[model samples]
Target: MGLLNRYAETLSELGSFVLPAPLKDMRVGLFNTTLANELALPEHLLQPQTMLDWLHSPVTPLTQQAFAQKYGGHQFGQWNPELGDGRGLLLAEVIDSNAQPHDLHLKGAGPTPYSRHADGRAVLRSTLREYIGAEALHYLGIPSSRSLCLFTSEDTVYRERPETGAMMIRTAPSHIRFGHFEYYFYASQKDKLQRLLDFTIEHHFAECKAATNPYAALLGAVVTRTARLVALWQTHGFVHGVMNTDNMSIHGITFDYGPFAFLDNYEPGAVFNHSDHQGRYAFNQQPGIALWNLNALAHAFSGHCSVDEIKAALSTFEPTFISQYQHLMLSRMGIETNEKEQSLAVMQSWLQILETNNLDYTYCFRQLALADINKAQCPFHDIFVSQENRFKQVTLVDQEKTDAWWESYRKLRLAREEETELLSLNPAVIPRTHLLQQAIELAEKGDFSLSESLLEATSTPYDARWDTHPFSKPPSSSTHTSLSCSS
Candidate 1:
């Protein structure tokens, strides 16, 4: 009972302690050996049989009491007070080799007090997606939660259809979310709210405590990190389908991967979550939605900071996001000029080219990075030749403008390590929706080989070896643009 179990012992008033409802015939489907070694997890916890027994057994010295966090959030722009960890539990906090603490959360563990009328179970299809999605984003250099292991069982769970029950152990700095503050704020629990703020700062943001106003400083830091995170997502064409306050982590990492997608054709208004009929969380709307979520969180700090101070903190969002996005977009194109306006013009023109040609987002960037400026006709040109033939959207005027943009780009100063920088900035492969569906289908048929291969491919997203791999290419024809939120 070291500091690993301190959260359960100290934060008892914030949540209710509960035991996990065991799954039948549970077995480890996938394990992150690298993450385990990085965290220096106990060797006994690495063994499947021992891990399963520990999960099912009564509380022990090592296995502390698990708890369901109580939180409230705004869903689809409507405030909902009755929301919490319906199907998840925070088993315990684990300290890494560097002494950094991370919450070991069990998603789909069992029903808790917040499981309002629904089964507290997760299916393999969704859990696998999350496991892959988290690793993919992490390798892509985005801040996100990471999966430790995936456990599947003979237990059946029903969603839109009968599916195999599964559980995934995801780790993050802390499980605290915007909703945690919101819940206490709205409930008028001032004492609990202050306790939470102090606890969070002490555990995660110790530097803030030295500031004149720690609460305001903490909010400002969160604003900057969230802005940067969303900028990275936009630059890489990733869309987090659900961005409710509860899903927004206070640590500013990507959380709750559900119905998320990467763009195939560069459409600004792409919305992949089937429930988003209004396109509220569409690709182009991500930045705006993020700011909206931040505003909701700001209300919780009203008692700690003045309205003007909170506004000042929130105001950093736009400039930070714009600067970060422009820098990333410029890097992705291999341009290193300090002239912000010109570089931004080039960035916009490049996006226009991709959008007009209806080209695959990842392919265009990878090909451009690999293109030779000395060659009159490089492989990058071939991508356009095929696209220009398929779509009549490219007029003579548009072609001229595109050619002019290319001429300017060719004349611009390149980065010191242009090709390497571009290659690293622009991933050769992403976890595309069609590819994920293929992996899921194979896994459902009792074959985890495809899933394992995908995890491996995604773990090294920038590897040149994947240049010609099937996973690098978007599906020839895709019917999975949008997905249900069942899982």
Candidate 2:
């Protein structure tokens, strides 16, 4: 059979592969069958009903020609000479039911020539988080990697602790990172860099094939998509925690859900990753970081594209992000698009209040969708402490200053074509930090019920029914001060 035909059959079943000897000591775990169903893969492909069955199966993976891709990227602002699918391998590329080609990767399956010094085993905890978090992000309509399968084993691996071993089948449009190009350039491998660029354009940037300078066009496209993606993250109050070059995808999908969090309250400067002590990837700094990463990527392509052209393309990040964010925020406010300054002023003032007061970001906007805007009668107000103090503070502000802002906001509302329109733009519930922690805590005890419930709630975050769920609350003082970069 042709390679594509053989791949088609494997997609229908968990066809075996010969495990490279280097990976023999690594433990295995299988994902739930539900993952196969999500991918619309054939039923037989989902072997081993539980993760345990798949993990211990003596069956080996198919031995196919390795699809080792080459690319470059920036690491913490410095150029790296070498980085590829160091530990993981791309098993195959299959077209899903949606006709989208997805790369199936076996993370921690074994070490390759790229494995530096660490074992290629993944921890169960991190695997579980990626499994569910990827699914959650997909359902939330964010461009992200999809979790096709997850497996766990009794074997112990030590990171911070001796944890059970696990592996995950990660799916994405393309695993190509900005660092891929950086790797070649830093090695002075211009010919190899050109080959990588050709392959990328052929596989992912076909739309730009006709452009005079396809490499520059490819950079531009990545910049545009990434800007919009980060804007979506900002609007939803999500912090990716780690914005490393290798973690940034060329197609703009959010990947590497390590130390990630949904903000409990609207703190623009919120930092979720404990490792990010300097706050380089804080909530508000995400956009800036994104631009920085893109610039690094552009620098890699400097050989093929002029520095002036790259700078002009990079310039699009700010305006594109601001415009996209403003539009999304306006939709959440249920205000029709109006070119007037008043409409924009209302959004500014409301966000300022949210940030200044440390209000529950998701609830405040959700409550605004209701009939009552008054704090005392607002069910949403309960999410905040008694608003008396806040209200008094608002009153104490120079009446003139407050009145000017309020009048501008009111005028913006007056221009709103209708009040009911904004409801769809704002979501009533987000995967709040406290609730996710609770779910993780329960999952750690071998109870997945809360995790399942939280998943269901987050899947329909905009639904009013979510208001009854306790998972929507902000973390108390006792919650972990920072999230760890674990599964």
The most accurate candidate by lDDT is 1
In model 1, which runs have C-alpha deviations exceeding 4 angstroms? 1-3, 61-63, 376-379, 387-399, 414-420, 478-480
Error of 1 at 365 (Å): 0.6
- For model 2, the local distance difference test gives 0.66
Work out the TM-score per prediction.
0.95, 0.84
Report the lDDT of model 2 for residue 187: 75
Model 2 worst lDDT window (10 residues) = 7-16
Model 1 lDDT per residue over 321-424, tens place: 99899888887887757677787788888888888767778878888887776544334555776555544444432556666777777766343344435677
Cα-based RMSD of the predictions, in order? 2.2, 5.2
TM-score of candidate 1 to 2 decimals: 0.95
Model 2 per-residue lDDT tens digits across residues 1-487: 1113223232222122334322334333334355555555544455544322333444423234333344445555666555555546565566667766666666666555555566756666666667677766776677888876655554677777767666777888767777777677777878767867777788778988999888889999999999999999998888888898888999999987788877765788888888887899899999999999988778778888898889878999999998898878777775545664656777787787666666667767776675343222324334344332433334222334434654555555566566645556666666665666666566555566776776676667777676666664444532234877743
Clashes of 2: 25
Model 2 stretches with alpha carbons more than 4 Å out: 1-43, 46-72, 371-383, 386-411, 478-480
